[model samples]
Target chain A: MDNSQLFFDFAPIWQARTLLLEGFGIAMFSAVAGIFFAILLGLIVALMRLSRYRALRAIAFTYTQLFRGVPLYVLVLWIYFGLVYAVGIDIPRIPSGIIALALLNSGYLSETFRSGILAVEKGQREAGEALGLRPWQVSRFIVLPQAGRIVVPPTGNQFVDAIKDSAILSIIGVPELMKVAQEQANMYYRPFEFYTVAGLLYLIAVIIVSKGISKLEQRLARFSRASKEASSGERRPSEVGG
Target chain B: MSETLLQLRNVGKRFGDHVVLKDINLDIAKGEVVCVIGPSGSGKSTLLRCINFIAPPEEGEVIFEGRTWKRFHSAFNFIANRKYEAKLPTLRAEIGMVFQHFNVFPHMTAIENVVLGLTKVRGNTRNVAREIAERSLRQVGLGDKLDQYPEKLSGGQKQRVAIARALALNPKVMLFDEVTSALDPELVTGILDEMRRLASDGMTMVVVTHEMNFAFQVATRIVFMDAGRIVTIGTPEEIRNTTEPRARAFLSSILG
Candidate 1:
């Protein structure tokens, strides 16, 4: 198509903005739902892997391996087609796709969380115990807070991945951003305009989310520094006298 | 004489085929300050860890507060082998430990670290915990550093804060594992001074230290370990004047 025609035809994106808005809304809803479940599942699996019980660790290991080994497309297809068709379950396509994404994302996120927990120095655990804290309390307060700092950057990356991966739900006819673009392209017979617009929208979303995460990281770092300064303030007078 | 607070009976630990500690039988009286001095790999730290049940002994028993020793089993092995097991958390409100590396929670402020045990483990109100934490920090001369994170503190400051964190729990016994070893030479005295104050306060303590001066000045008794066993246990004067060649050699070497 000619550049002028492409530009004019793409004007329909603004005119039919409600459709685009609806698509964006659906993608966001699915991404948020998927991430919430993914985090919850990831935390459980991570804890299971760290458990002192051999069977519990083995079970968690198997779950991560099985889900992470398969491609996202296969998982989505299996959930939408295989499970829904074979079991004759009446679950909607959107919910099914969300479950699949959450399940898949959790496997990878679990490993991230596990590594973060492990990265914390062993001495911290000992210190917690020395303070008479129970093992569970140690994990909840000392270990997890430190681990959260180490895990956030990677977890933020996974969240970005989750948002992008929501596009895969389009295959199940959930009418996400990519699917909307696809339908528009097919109807207008202008693949270049619609697909480019869709790609830009995705880029914008990712950029905004990533910037927000960076801001959060900076704020946390500053908070930590301020606390340190306040503590050091006590020693300054003593150091000068000495 | 103080009452016996902790007893180690035929305590032994092995990692696979390598024995780390063996045939350790000792009793520590309450309010006694004992210093353990030994070469690296002599298991001085391991023995300290065993007191708090940080490391379980493979054989024998540990008695605390005159109670009989209890056996704990591993859950992982039981799940794999289909045998029921018992896992116990042996940490009591009585025992507190500090490591050589000053393992303060990097994410928490100094006051928060000190208050964590009081509020979370002891079930104290937040205000009460904070009050106790501040008092402990003041005792350690860290009164102004209530909100500082570990990474921002110097080695000596961090170690002092760790001591306060332990003291905030109101532990009856405190264990120190070479706490000053990681400090800069100039900073070492600050931490040692704080420890000396703790010792003077009649806080029950077992300290593993390389600083001979600190041990000589502060320890009520000094126990020397070598090759995973206690070679000598005596007062500083006894250790200094002993005719035993090993004791003389160790003392001279450390002093030199």
Candidate 2:
């Protein structure tokens, strides 16, 4: 009994191009949309957490802690399975998946943003004040620009995180990449081939997103010429796209 | 004496258990440089901060123009005026401040730094703000370095840019907080020269400085503080004569 019947193939996936492409589209869509919402929510939560009002700080803290502590799968399930049916409202699974991932990412990214805001030096704030900038203006014009450069790497990681986490929403019946892979594997009884294909697709997507983010960071990093002298990671212009 | 431009009446401030400033009353007139000199922890900087309403003195009032600056709230937050914090940009625009460490915005060019307050707070057009910034930068002898970032500047040049930043606002009263303390001894003269030029131009200024010679030459009146109080307020000649023990001690300690 030489049970050596296991084999790998990419031909089947290629034949199922339309299905794979549609699933890829959904995955990409959710990642992009989720990140937009996450950054927006993170900005709001960060500001609230930094506010002088105790109640606001408490509320922001609760949102950050509760969501961050909960697993991404649990939050997605709670929103798609528990909240939707409980409210007796018929919502689409695609949007529900994006919302869950965004809400969860916001909780995580807000902490990143808060740390970034803190990274700004005390002198910069005072500089804005002495110039007579309003408090909000100082935060908007000076601190946020400085904080943004600091938070770039973390935020790029979060974007990829959201993209990968979007796959988990397939349990709630979202037709994302993982959903397509699971069905294809079951129908063809080739789990290895289907899963590996899905994984590689995600890797490619992440590489593109990561490279784009690094370029943006490079532009932002150029603003602080002083920091560059001390910063360890210096990108030579010739190294770009090499 | 000329017209009174700014008056601090019975101003007092404290930090937790320590009294940083108390019963600090001073009058500033137009075209006068009022230099506040004292030993460390003498509250000269704190008093300058209170003048710009940075700390919002816990006690007493600041009468500037026709408006009065007093405590709007009791909170210890960094916001200058709690109730009018929104409007403070306008008030602060009228009264500019230069810090000891030259707090120029590192992210912006020298010209951009100079014009930020004008465009952002004063609502001036971009072209108008740039023109004013360029002119002010020229006045500070940084006309050619307007495009340089703060990190590219020397201590003297950075402080000059900071001064230009404040000067662009055309403030009624300029507050200088140890602007030369952080510069090299050689760099100190450039900023002192700028201050002297400003003084001769009839700009009302309140300067908290450790530069005794600068105070002697430029200040119309000298205020010597110790232990969080103004020990003596007199002309440069009077401070030079040294009647008050605290002033004499501080002057001798610093001058020598």
Candidate 3:
């Protein structure tokens, strides 16, 4: 209670190390799963957006606009609390949190994929088809490989954003890193110390991810110099994840 | 002459409301080198595209190797489109096309680009595909550059790789759509010379070209088109002596 000197305590963080580590583990797991599912779903949505059928394109467009327009916080609440009451299906906190993260990020990822796919020249597709490669084979072999180079850097940024956004799941009592910090701060009356540790954990994750993305970009650049030219001066989407 | 290898009977094509090609009839014989020449937008490239249904004609039929490909209805032709889609791969394998831009896949090395069709479409083993791809690249004088990606290759080299890619399939006929238009004037001869060798080897070829001398020398028959219609079809000597105003005007303008 003495105001003679400003002091910080690391004792509480050490005392709550096991709980904090477990919470951080949960958060990392959620981020990985969310981004994984989002990528798969994003690719399908991207293909649907580019589909020849008007009905499929309409559905995909609506899905993208709706998810992207809604705030991630509101989406989490709607899926976790609102869906149970409105749809008569009770969902667990972990699944609800993961689903919300996936839905919100997928809107962004699908757009990334769509632009990536579009950036591939029309002639590439024609060349593949002229070689007698089937439509699917053309996409899998020719278009997507070229598109993958374009999308990798942006998708890596999305992964970093998803890790930070996972903190929002703590509000739904999902017991992630932020949730653990909150409990420890309240218990020991050391909010500053606990929150700082939590922030550092997230920063470390981001730095590691950024390194991996750069390595991947370098490997892909060997194939086409156009990708290097393409990666420059691209209009970045407005940040909506966290 | 030899047997008819391909026939385009009354073929028509339009984009939206503007007609690109109409009532086009032509016959190609096996091992014949037919060069199509005209000004830009003459539908010469469109005609080549139709040969493989890359831009399937809206009217009439394309008869290749005695098999007929025709559209039933313009609006509800998805059924026809689907049928062609299913049958096209096998036929496209036999009908090789080298584009003006040399659309060689950028992500693959020269050998890999040539090997793709053999391994994927033809379902050859990787080893066998590599052997064939090497042979094809060697034929195009690119054996030393087989491991190089498209970006590392020059325009003429890229075109050679594209030709090798098409050639690797051992096609019944080859289609060249302005393949030398993108190259430098100095680099044009390398490709034209390679094509001349192809023609001399008795490969059936449909060449869309602007090089008048190549057409006059290598082509067994020269087709002069204007406004989506064939204005003249004759031997090089006959085309040189044609009295058709449009054909005569086109030849003089370019030749002069």
What are the per-model C-alpha RMSD values against the true structure?
5.5, 6.2, 5.3
lDDT tens per residue, model 2, A1-242: 32236466666787777897799889989988988999999999999999989999999999999889999889887887788679876567988888888899999999999988987766678778877888888998888988888899999999999888888988988888999999988877778888998999999999999999999878776665554432221232311110
**How well is each residue in A53-102 modelled by candidate 3, as lDDT tens digits?**
99999999999998889988998899889988998778899898889888
Write down the lDDT that model 3 would get.
0.89
CAPRI tier of model 3: acceptable
What lDDT tens digits, residue by residue, belong to model 1 across residues B1-256?
A: 7799888898888778978888888888988889998777788988888777777677778788876654445645545333211223344567888877777777888898888888887889999999999999998888888887776778788888888888887788899988887678999888888888888788899999888988988888898887778888888888878787776787888787
Sorted on lDDT, best first, the list reads 3, 2, 1
The parts of candidate 1 lying over 4 Å away from their true place are A1-8, A222-242, B72-91
DockQ of each: 0.32, 0.29, 0.36
Worst 10 residues of 1 chain A by lDDT: A233-242
Model 1 Cα lDDT, one tens digit per residue, A105-207: 8999999999988877667787787777778888999888877776777888888998899999999899888899889878777777778888888888889
TM-score of each candidate's B chain against the true B chain: 0.91, 0.94, 0.97
Better of 1 and 2 by TM-score: 2
Top of the candidates by DockQ: 3
Cα error of candidate 2 at position B100, Å: 1.6
lDDT of each: 0.80, 0.84, 0.89
* lDDT score at residue A73, model 2, on the 0-100 scale: 85
